[model samples]
Target: MVSPLTVVKSEGPKLVPFFKATCVYFVLWLPSSNPTWFSALIKCLPIFCLCLFLLAHGLGFLQTHPSATRIFVGLIFSAVGDAFLIWQDQGYFVHGLLMFAVTHMFYASAFGMKPLDLRKGLVIAVLSGSSYALLYPCLSGAFTYLVGVYVAIISFMGWRALAGLQLIGAAWRWTKLAAGSGALLFILSDMTIALNKFCFPVPHSRAIIMSTYYAAQMLITLSAVESREPVEAYGLSKTN
Candidate 1:
């Protein structure tokens, strides 16, 4: 895909709300042991803001770049996942995992599987497969297949992102970098979660997970805005 360098940056003001919501979660919610049920709203605020940001950026992309639209929908699913996760100790882990699995499917669909380089896909698959193996002993019988399936989907998502990152002409473009980095960071975030819950406790796991997760989402959101168009491109009319 082309870089579409003309619209490389998203509107900075639109990100303020997302950052503010993240700060509130990290500062007030993450540290609180007695967080109220209503705090689930705070947990989802950043994702909600991101969905609004994508909509506010514009909808014209849906005509030519359905990928951006898919990511927007993915973010909405992520928000639901976040809500379910807050109650994980109450048996919502599986529900939350299901939502996030759907989120990865949307992201993988948005990333596309074109230029399917076996080398790249294989590398990602090996990494994800090894990770699942590492966690195999800790996984409960009920969730063994579920977690395995989730890992496979996310690994495929990363493979698709990696393939796009090496677009013949736009190898070094910000769109590629953003999407690729976002996918990697997303993998790291989920891996951290698995280690914390299934394998062993990670130091400050919640903070690390949230920080990387939000940053990954932010980068992915920016990529959608950059890859899609604005009102026009040079002398070429997008409406054409």
Candidate 2:
């Protein structure tokens, strides 16, 4: 069988698609005011490219890392959410939010649950609770509960990410760090969206949100690739 390092080296250059897709979104789609089909396609390109990059490893990748397939699902949902959000003026806000909520759930599943690290849970609870308090006055109607659920789901995702990763060595440490940072960045991007939408306008929010979000997804994807070499660190033997 081929080694993990060989796979990574062979796949590294395939990242070109991911970069080009990201560049297209930030440059051509983000600046445009019009919400056309073309713009929607551009918006979801990065995630689609991410999925492609993962699929490049073939189905065998799943055996290498238990979360590989779930991560792919999460990326797909993220892409859908991105496209739906582009039509927010047409009342697709709830759809977008729901899609992303599902996305987070898949991500949490990918992270798995074990050790039940209450410390991480407590920190996430505080952050989520504080964020909810700040956004409380702004939430109303169906969103009152809707946003609350979304916050809870994302918080759980964050906690799972923090608790799930382990830094046993240099390679494992980088993978763990990337996954953890991705989770935090995901939360930060959402916070920026919440502040800009439900509260006062955030300066440069559009760029901040999209940039952080892309960075978050990219980091998470890379972590999965990095984890393949040492699947033992991920505690897959316990689950599978």
Q: Tell me the tens digit of each residue's lDDT in model 1 across 1-240.
A: 443544434367788899999998878755335545678888888999988888786676554567788898899899889888888887888898999889889988877777678899889988998999998999988889999999998898888877867535535666667788999999999999999999899998988898899999988887776553333432445452
- Residue-wise C-alpha lDDT for candidate 2, range 1-240, written one tens digit per residue: 335577557766878898898898776744445788788899888899989888887777867677777888999999889888989878999999999999999888877776579988998999899999999999889988998999999999889878856666433455566678999999999999998999899999999998999999987887677543356775655463
lDDT of each: 0.81, 0.84
Question: What are the clashing pairs of model 1?
Answer: none
TM-score of each: 0.87, 0.86
Clashing pairs in 2: none
| Model 2: residues with Cα > 4 Å off, grouped in runs | 1-11, 30-32, 166-172, 226-240
Position 156, candidate 1: lDDT: 87
Candidate 2 local Cα displacement, residue 208, angstroms: 0.1
Best prediction by TM-score: 1
